[model samples]
Target: MTQFAAEMIGTFFIILLGNGVVANVVLNGTKGNNGGWIVITTGWALAVFVGVVIAAPFSGAHLNPAVTLALAMAQKFSWAKVPLFILAQFTGAMLGAVAVWLVYKDHFLKTPDKGLKSAAFFTSPAIRNNSSNFFSEVLGTFVLIFVIFYFTNAEMGNDKTPIGLGSLGAIPVAFLVWAIGLSLGGTTGYAINPARDLGPRIMHALLPINGKGSSEWNYSWIPVAGPLVGSALAALLYLWLRI
Candidate 1:
């Protein structure tokens, strides 16, 4: 597959299963209903594993814009390709969000709670403090990108041959994500990836779901900006450490 196609398809699966779990848990009357936070976190980690397995060969599976940005800053990926990769990630995420809505349409209608419906689509701060919410996202993503730097370090040389996780590499990454969710996700839902949140948030606004309520545009920037900032910091630190 072409890199763009690989990225798009990979991220599609990420959201397909990631958000899919949320819908199954939060939306009404599903088999996985009330499966709880562990289920959601596990689903998301597995979703990352699946996406990485699919895209690692062709695209390196930089499935999140934050990841793409970090690699470029760290000189592990091409600056010229950043925009294309990010576009594919966002496109895939939006498509995946639509797929989740379609799969859970009946439950969405039955749920009746607008916030619950929104929860299935994107992250929201549990406490609604903008500063804390931003800090939570930053710290969560800092851990993500920072650890990813070390994960790739052994294989990454001057040529940067394997810039992202391989199929086996997905295992550690999955555990890393799961750990982040279990430890730090409570604050802002740990939207450590920008495309993972914003693309779906946009879809939540556009799609016609019953009682889906406000998309919370006011709080939307935190997820996007926080991860990007976190990524930059991680990349800079990695570079400094190497020097």
Candidate 2:
């Protein structure tokens, strides 16, 4: 598959399953209803695994824009290709979100709580503290990109090259995401990827969901900016350590 198509398809699955779990748990009624935090985290981890396995050979599975930025910053990926990769990631994320909504349309209508409906589309802070929320995202993403640097040993480029162990190579990243979600996700839902949060959030605003309420645009920047800042910091640190 082409890199663009691979990224789009991969992120499509990420949102399809990741937000899907939220819809199943938070919406009015479903088999996974109230499956709780562990279920949500596990679902997201598996989503990452699936996405990475599908896209790694073609796009290095930089399904998250923060990851693409960090790879460029670390000199492992081409700056020239950054924008294309990011566009593909966002496209895939938005499409994935739409798929989730379609799959859970009935439940979305049944769920009266606007917040619950929004939860299936984007992340929101458990407690709204701007600085604290930003810090949580930054720290969570720092852990993500920093660890990923080590995983690739600073050598994996965004070019279409197969990653190690094929499908099994995706495991470490899945576990890393799971760890971040379990340990640090409570504060701000661990929106460690700009495209992952903002893309679907845009969709939440545009889609015709009943009583979906405000898109929470005011607080949207943190998820995008925080991850970018964290990614740059992690890349800088990795470069410095190498030096």
Which number leads on lDDT? 1
* lDDT tens readout by residue for model 2, 38-58: 999999999999999899887
Question: What do the candidate models score in CA lDDT, each in turn?
Answer: 0.89, 0.87
Model 1 misplaced regions, further than 4 Å: 154-160
Task: Indicate the residue-level lDDT of 32 in model 2.
Answer: 90
Backbone clashes in model 2, listed as residue pairs? none
Error of 2 at 205 (Å): 0.6
- Across residues 160-189, which tens digit of lDDT does each residue of candidate 1 receive? 344655423788889989999999999998
Q: Which residue window of length 10 is worst by lDDT in model 2? A: 158-167
Consecutive 10-residue window with the lowest summed lDDT within model 1: 153-162
Give the lDDT of residue 134 in candidate 2: 94
Each candidate's number of clashing pairs is 0, 0
